[model samples]
Target: MQYVQRADRKIVGYEETEYDQNRRNSRDQGKKKFSRTMALILGVVLTLELMIMGAMLFHIDFHSADRIAMVFAFAVLYFGVVAGLTDK
Candidate 1:
């Protein structure tokens, strides 16, 4: 357990902020593993998407609309994953 000492050098009982910070720290420690896993997955997905986009462009099938869609989709998915799993 972690603790904070007050200005007077006395150990203060856990305040709400301290509790929240500790909770966030613990949660983030666990989520480090999850984050690494997700990073691996995202890397593969992004690579595949890039390959597909490249192939489409090579075939002259790429459109401005497709690029826009891909950008927006990637942004939304990235934000959704991060925000959905993050601790306050």
Candidate 2:
């Protein structure tokens, strides 16, 4: 057991066992991996969405409901993905 102090006051006494330290390190590593994976997936999705939108806009062929629907779907998906990733 070790005593933790602050400003000459003993806050508490707790033992930081090796097992606890190892568990904490593993959890941190997992979070890093998850964050990296999410960032990569989101980056690819966003890039593809932007490219498609740019092509459609430059062509000026958004005259059909199908095209508009597709754009709308992409917009919804983009927002949904962002929200989902950020909520974590």
Candidate 3:
């Protein structure tokens, strides 16, 4: 594989060997893992937001109170997804 970079308005080419590809793949995997982690965190936040909104609408109703469990549930799921995607 070969990669080209623009330096000083000129194209510079570098030969990418198999080892380079492996390293690049690892780096790309890291990026993917980070994105997934962010997405999981966002999901948790959104769940909490929805739960809060629901509770407000219900005005302390029992069914709405049940949604409070969703916050912890979603948090666990978020961590699980992130941990599964990332390498130890």
Backbone clashes (count) for model 2: 0
lDDT sort, best first: 2, 3, 1
lDDT, candidate 3, 1-88, per-residue tens: 4657676677777788889989989988865334655666766676667657766886757555556685576667656655665545
Error of 3 at 45 (Å): 0.3
Q: By the TM-score metric, which is better: model 1 or model 3?
A: 3
Worst 10 residues of 2 by lDDT: 31-40
Q: Among these predicted structures, which one has the highest lDDT?
A: 2
Q: What is the TM-score of each candidate against the true structure?
A: 0.31, 0.47, 0.33
Question: What lDDT does the true structure give each of the candidates?
Answer: 0.65, 0.70, 0.66
